[model samples]
Every structure is written in C-alpha cells, then in structure tokens.
Target: VTVCCVAADPPAEAWVKGGPVDPNLLGATTRSFLAKVLTSLMDRFEQDDDKDTVAAAGEALAQLAMLLGGPGVHSVTQRLIDTCLQLLQQEHICQSSDDELDGEEDHDGALWEAVSELLM
Candidate 1:
C-alpha cells in the first residue's frame, strides 16, 4: 500500500546484482512498480533540462536497467531503446554542454558508459 512497503519488500538480491533473476519472480504489482520507476527516471531525464538532474536520472535509469536484466527490461520498449541509442550517438554532448542551474555537473562519458554497461 505504501512506497516503502513495495520497494523494501522486494528481495534485495533481485536488485543488487544483475545476475540471472529468478524467472518466477516478482508479483504483478511489483513488476508494475518496476515499470513505473523505469518510466519515471526516463521522464525525469527528459523534463530535467538541467545537466545535473538529467545526468542523475540517466544514472538511475542505468542502474535500474542493470538490475532489471534482460527479462526485467521487457517492460520498457521504445523509451529504453531510445535512451540507449541517444547515449550512443551523443557520447560527448552532455559533457560539453550543460545548464548548471541545479549545480549538477555534466559527465557525458559517464552517461554513455552507464547505459552501455547496463545493456551489457
């Protein structure tokens, strides 16, 4: 019923490592929560014109992608692929150009690297 109830209840092993998550894992509700978190991070990255939040959001997405694994990634279709592709194409764009409004420094390399690593 609560955010804490959902996130904290999920087995930590499923999220901490990107190894093969159990096929018969996560209830429907939990899966939906994962979908929301992934979507929210991607959306946050898009809305956040600032370099810091954008970069942070990207990092969060990358981490989520990692834990989610191949099976876990079935939820996000276009958004995940688009973000990954964008990072591939603009590897150095963020590092060079950024709005420092929120004191979030830019690291183009990290963003690209994070996504790449996630998909790996």
Candidate 2:
C-alpha cells in the first residue's frame, strides 16, 4: 500500500550515471513517494470525519517529519506556516472572540515546537 511505498528505498535501477533516470518499471524515490503520502495524510487530517483516522494521520505527520530530516521537514512545515499565515493575513481566519486568538496562539506554539525539534 501507500505506507509500504513511502517506507521503501528507491530501486537501484532508478539511478544511472550518478543522476536520476527514468526507472519506468521501478517506482518513485522515497522523497517523491512520501510527498504523495504526506499530502494524502494532510488531506485526510482535514477531511476525514472519523476521529481515529484523523488522529492517526496527525501522528503519521510527526513520524514523517522525523523521517524527512531538517530540510525536508522544513519544507513541509514552511508550507503549513505559509498556508496559515495566508489565512490570517487575508482575513480568512475568523476572530469572533478572545478565545479564537488564544486558539491560534496555541496552534502557533505547537507548530513552532515541531519545527524546532525537526531542526535539532
């Protein structure tokens, strides 16, 4: 399945002459395959109605961050931050009360911690 694909190493035949070549029969590189997996997980995190499934997706994201290393994790987190910041800057985020701001702060704090851990 997708998880197995994401966890797999790229095939030896996937590279040639010290460069990436089309390994048509072989599959995608780890990074490329995992990107799809991460995107699917993120989509499910937002769209899934089942609490357990959503929770698992969230955990999967943390595990993926660990697997991806600093630069890759930064790429993922930066996309998240950019999306959130865009919502805030574009006034897409509703500020109905003080509680909303508090919630936003909580999310921001957690995101910062995740990024810091990835960097370290």
Candidate 3:
C-alpha cells in the first residue's frame, strides 16, 4: 500500500518538467517505475479478495491516470471499466434494504465507488 501511494505520487524531481507528465513522454527511469507501479496495482486490484485493498489499488490506478494526462488516460479508463464490468458479470452484486452489503458484495460496491472517483 505504501509503495502504491509513493508510486502514485512520484518525486517532483522524477518528472522531466518537475511535475506530472505523459507516461509515454517520460524518461526511461520514470517510465520503468510507472510500468512497475501500474502492473503491481493492477495485479492487486484483480487478485486481492480484500475489499479495502482492492479499493485502494483502484484508487491508486485512478490517481496515476490523472497524473499522466494523455492518451494513456483512455487506456487506463478502459481497463478499469472492463475490469469492473467483468467483476459485475461474474458476481451478482446485491444491496440490502438498509443500503449495506456484506462479504463479496461489499467488494463490488467498493470497486464501483473507486471507478466512480476515477471517472470524475
């Protein structure tokens, strides 16, 4: 989690312009770091059964996408949407009358929330 947070918010000096830049336009070092961070977060988001952890990864991915504002944003957005849709198709997300979810259901809800944040 710490690694993801740090990766999402790279050091100011890591950027070619002292701030966020398009991943494709980044230097080799920054590009490598970005790839590793994206892979790790995607892996966690896809494989983790823990709702909180998955949500965190999703949020990190969103943050990274925002940081790298370019054509990469479209790819990341598509991947997130596809993953969320796959999860929805594989499981039946249900909510109780009290607007609460449990166990696996909570995972889906949290993921949707993260995706919503990403889209916004």
Q: Pick the candidate with the highest lDDT.
A: 3
* Root-mean-square deviation of candidate 2: 7.7
Predictions in order: lDDT: 0.56, 0.47, 0.58
17-62, model 3: which lDDT tens digit per residue? 2344445454455455666677778777666755677778878877
Where model 1 places Cα greater than 4 Å from the true spot, the runs are 1-25, 91-106
Order of all candidates by lDDT, from best down to worst? 3, 1, 2
**Candidate 3 residue runs with Cα over 4 Å from true position:** 1-23, 71-78, 88-109
TM-score of each: 0.56, 0.41, 0.56
Q: Model 2: per-residue lDDT, tens digit, 12-106?
A: 44332324333332345665665567678767544554334544555566665544433233445665455335334532222222354435665
**How many residue pairs clash per model?**
0, 0, 0
Each model's Cα RMSD: 5.4, 7.7, 6.7
Better of 2 and 3 by lDDT: 3
- Model 3 scores worst on lDDT over the 10 consecutive residues at 91-100
The regions of model 2 sitting more than 4 angstroms off are: 1-28, 78-120
- lDDT (Cα, 0-100) at 35 in candidate 3: 62
* Cα shift from native, residue 94, model 1 (Å): 5.8
